[model samples]
Target chain A: MKVLNEMSVNFESRSVNEAFARTAAAAFAAQLDPTVAELNEIRTAVSEAVTNCVVHAYRDTIGIISMNIRIAEGNILIVKIRDRGCGIEDIPRAMEPLFTTSPEDERAGLGFAVMQSFTDKLTVRSKPGKGTTVTLEKRLSPRLSDV
Target chain B: MLLKPKTMFDGKVLTVYLSGDIDHHSARRIREYTDALIGELKPVRLLLNYSAVSFMDSSGIGLIMGRYRMMKLYGGSVSVVSIPPALRKMMELSGLGCLDVLEGGNEENESA
Candidate 1:
């Protein structure tokens, strides 16, 4: 298959990787003529999803989180974030808002919810212990609009 | 990511100004500091001046919700002021409007 326009990156620490993902996504979306708000929605949504992989999936362990940024159908932006860490056991239960298995931590279980809130679409595929992949899809607008 | 808390009126109205980006990593600390300050200062009111905040994600929402919860218990109110229109939309969708997310400055309560 022929590869389209895309960006791939990796980081050792979770602290800066999410920021880098958003920055990289913004740079790409900006070139596509998306408004700042739309870009932010895409960026923040991607960041939240990726951060989930970092903080929850792997728990800040040493792993490579991969991001694939590609434009789809002229106006849609798609991002796939995957991590080879401890995967999710129950997909449906985990997707629920405020559903965190870890109560010892202060997680609000808003990571996936926030991603879903900002993005046009989101899909999570995971196993019990192998790894997890979170895909975020957004339809970009020409300009950033505030309602 | 620097946190600047501006104390006004003998520390009656404590407005904590957050700059830079708010995300998963920073949300934890922000929540901790905010809760500690709220307990210690015990202000009459609180406001999050996000004027300098360049970016925020879902973690930001959690922090705001946490503060809102804390404020309710103390009989005080927490307001978000000077939000950029883009960020404002996020707040609006998150039910901050129904929760009464303030949209103006402290001018309304200056004389209070």
Candidate 2:
């Protein structure tokens, strides 16, 4: 797929940055002229991805979380969030709804589920002891103004 | 930024007014504060007002689930009120709606 526009950002894997990451993604996706619902979905997906990096990936210490946003052809918005911390041992199990590693922390384990529900496509690539990368893709609805 | 939740407690019910974004960062603080109140008040019912919540994700689900568990331990029940339309899908996806925690239907209740 041809990329129309792209932006990359790296920030500390802190919970506070979760809002920043998602808001930045939404701002970047605004070029697609997404509806309110589309914009909200993107923000929620990005928040879940970044929160994973902060809570699960870098559980014990602070680390760097890198996010890349791209607008691909056909008005598709692609978001990539990466963390160079403790990676997932089993991607499939981790993605299961309500399967949280940190139950003690009151995590409902709905992060992956929410992302999947909100986005058009969800991809996870990880290696234990290496890192994790989550890619979210959503096709924006074509607006009448665009037509 | 942490949005402090406003709480009102009658003898039998505790209402928590939650606003702004409910993400991991904010959820932690809110959980801690609200849990303390639940421990102290021990209301028969816990009502969470989401009329002003602008954004939420899975963290919001976690918050509700945690509160539900807490209330259950105290022989109390939990219900959500005034969920914004934007967050209705999230509540549905998390099966909170199935649990009947959504006080009224999915309609946005501004006056709540």
Best by lDDT: 2
Q: Against the true chain A, what TM-score does chain A of candidate 2 give?
A: 0.98
Across residues A1-147, which tens digit of lDDT does each residue of candidate 1 receive?
A: 233477777765466677887888788877678767787788788777777777777884778788888876546777888888899989889988777765444555667777888888889999877889888877766444423
Off by over 4 Å in 1: A1-3, A102-106, A142-147, B3-9, B73-75, B101-112
What would the per-residue lDDT of candidate 2 be over residues A31-143, giving only the tens digit for each residue?
89999999999999999999999999999799999999999888999999999999999999999998999999888899999999999999999999999999999999988
Instruction: Say which docking band candidate 2 falls in.
Output: high
Model 2: runs farther than 4 Å from truth? B1-3, B105-112
User: lDDT of candidate 1?
Assistant: 0.75
* Pairs clashing within candidate 2: none
lDDT of 1 at B7: 39
C-alpha DockQ of every model? 0.45, 0.91
Sort candidate 1 into its docking category.
acceptable
**Per-model TM values vs. the true structure:** 0.84, 0.96
